[model samples]
Target: METAGLVLAAGEGKRYGMPKALAKHGDRLLVQHAAETLRAAGCERRIVVLGAAADEVRAAAPDLPETVVNPDWATGMASSLKAGLAALAGTPAIAAVILLVDMPGVTAEAVRRILGHAARDALVMGGYGDRRGHPVLLGRDHWDGVARTATGDRGARDYLRTHDVRVVPVGDVADDHDIDTR
Candidate 1:
């Protein structure tokens, strides 16, 4: 099975006073941490959905698998997601494993686990303590649905509600941790 990794690094980080992707957490930027986690999970192809400080954030991951700039990032996470989905449109054999640049707490093991079961449904998310969060895995079948997502506060949660999901529960704390300071 083919799989692709997508990182959402387009946020303006209004509350963090800088691009969220460039924020420092530990010794690395949040987006770098996230991209590293995804890359470690054995994803052959990677894509970054960038906006705001697109150039700066893209440059941060010089060896990143690939990069896709999301000009509609001003619209919000939904736009970034759709942008990533569009980039994956040509790769029908690969699943898109998405990560949030701000949520650096999500571990690589969790992402591997999610990808391990991607074929179960169109969408598979890492669940922790009753809440499912990112590093969400989407099989090739859902690419069209995700790419067609509309503007104004759209996201995978709404689409998942209409389909069956393979929810993998994690006993870890990353599920409840909200990285956004705002």
Candidate 2:
């Protein structure tokens, strides 16, 4: 099955005083880093969800893959997730590996590890020892349920909690530390 990559980079980053997608990591913007990470991880297709400073992000990262702007981004991360998933609905991909733009520590290797569990019925997440984290793999079968439960920054947490989610330990190759501040 073809697994697509969904980058959720629409947050306004209230804590950081700017949009996290525009934040710089090394020489690349966080959103660029996110899309590149997914590409390096071998996702057959990639889509970025932009919000807040959508025009600025587009102008800054002109080479990014397909992008969808979430009109309700001010609401929360859930809106971005919904937008990304909705954009992927027409694709041939059977699953999507979800990543957050602010998480610079989640490397391509970690995403590749999660991609191994991609399936129409799969619900997998990366685990850091005992703590579950980003790069969650959501199969096509659960997209509807995830979209339904995704609301007010919860994203897919509510749906994952009620389902059987396979956790793959990727701490050895990646870190889940998110850049929430300057």
Candidate 3:
């Protein structure tokens, strides 16, 4: 299926004391890493939602991909998610792999695994052992409902809780840890 990469990097990172999207994981910025991972995993197009430090993040990773600033980002992740989804509205992609900039541990292989199992009628999540996490694949068929229920820091989480999500264990291929705190 044709899939797009949606990176939610607009958070102010209140706890981290800075924009987490600009946080460095070795040589690459967190947002850059996430976008690159998505590209490597086969996203036809990559769209990033920037808010906290939009210009700085863009300057740091100019070639990342298409980016949009979430004016309502102060509200939370839901806004960023909505912005990214909106950016993908007119694309040829049949689905999108949702990624968080704070998740530097997520690797391209994990994304590939998740994409490999995606279906138009189902939700696909990367599982780290017993816990399902990032790189959530939302088929076009379910986008509207997901967007409707997404709010605050709970982007798509509530919707997924009420749906049957297909999990692909990727513990060995990637880490599911989120760098939300110091």
Candidate 4:
């Protein structure tokens, strides 16, 4: 079962000032970093969801893997997550490791740990001690439910909350801190 990587890079970054995808985290843009992190973690297929200055992000990071533009991105994160999952519908991926672009601290090791639980019915996420965080692995079996309840900024939180989720501890291997401000 191939686990695809889904990078949600559509946020406008109202708090950080600028599109989060365009934000630089070292030499590469946040979108590039997120996608590269997934690739390094052994995800053979990677898709990036772009919005809120999609053209600029595409121009800035021309090397990004297959990208899907979310027309309703201004609504919230849910749109981007839905767009990314819709793009994955045609692939052979059994699960997707979801990552947020602004989360520059999320490392490949953390994603790899989540990938270990990939399956058609698996719902797993990385845990930092007692706290759960990204990247969340959503199996194909739960995609419909996730998409249904993913409204506004909730994303898959509503669905995951009601389902059996496995939280993999990865604080020692990665950081889940998001770059919310400059």
Per-candidate clashes come to 0, 0, 0, 0
Q: Candidate 3, residues 1-182: lDDT per residue as tens digits?
A: 58888999998999999999889988989988998999998886999999988999989888889899999999999988888888888887788899999988899999999888766676999888789998799998888898899999999999999999999998898988899776
- Note each model's CA RMSD in angstroms: 2.0, 0.6, 1.1, 0.6
On the 0 to 100 scale, the lDDT of residue 82 in model 2 is 93
For model 1, residues 1-182, the per-residue Cα lDDT tens digits are 77888888888988878888878878877777777888888877778788898888767756555778888888888888888888878775457888888777788888888878766245888887666777688887787776665455456777777777878875463543646673
* lDDT for residue 28 in candidate 1, whole number 0-100: 76
* Cα lDDT, model 4, residue 16: 86
Candidate 2: worst-modelled 10 consecutive residues by lDDT: 43-52
- lDDT per model vs. reference: 0.77, 0.94, 0.89, 0.93
Instruction: Write out the backbone clash pairs for model 3.
Output: none
**lDDT score of model 1?**
0.77
Q: Which runs of model 4 end up more than 4 angstroms from their true locations?
A: none
Query: Candidate 1 versus the native: TM-score?
Result: 0.90
Candidate 1 residue pairs that clash: none
Lowest lDDT 10-mer window, candidate 3? 113-122
Better of 3 and 4 by TM-score: 4
